[model samples]
Target: MDKITYDGIRNFIIENELTDSVAISLHPDSFDELVMDYLDINNNQIERPFEILGIEILQDSTGSVQKNKVNILNVV
Candidate 1:
């Protein structure tokens, strides 16, 4: 699994113009667990609440299971 950093995720949202959207993960396996782990690791450093949108199964061009794609939404 690729390491997804907090800064990287936040920057993605900002760069993609998703400032008002909640965070999301599109991985069938352990998407929630990954998000929780991320939060647990950076719990003390972060102040603002980062909400998750939802989870879905994502695939690559070759039809292989790809890494979870994190997105955002305006509400839950």
Candidate 2:
């Protein structure tokens, strides 16, 4: 992600007081292992549903940052 997007997300998390619930994983299998690992590592036993926004940013031929895929995962 670019600096602007990163900063915006960071600010949103901080302002909403969701620092403990959000995690960023850059690996290919981020959704499969990283999310689970984060939950286990943090011992987060959240009873309610939480959302994970998976953003895939890529550069087009013109070298502009483009958002390719956005997947919203609701984990209960």
Name the weakest run of 10 consecutive residues (lDDT summed) in model 1: 52-61
Which ranges in model 2 have alpha carbons more than 4 Å from their true place?
1-4, 22-76
Question: To one decimal, what is the Cα RMSD in angstroms of model 1 from the true structure?
Answer: 7.1
Every model's TM-score: 0.40, 0.25
Looking at model 1, the pairs that clash are 21-73, 22-73
Tens digit per residue, CA lDDT, model 1, 1-76: 2544445555555566564434344444444444556667776443334432222212123324345555332344
lDDT of 1 at 73: 28
lDDT score at residue 58, model 1, on the 0-100 scale:
23
Give the top-scoring candidate (lDDT): 1
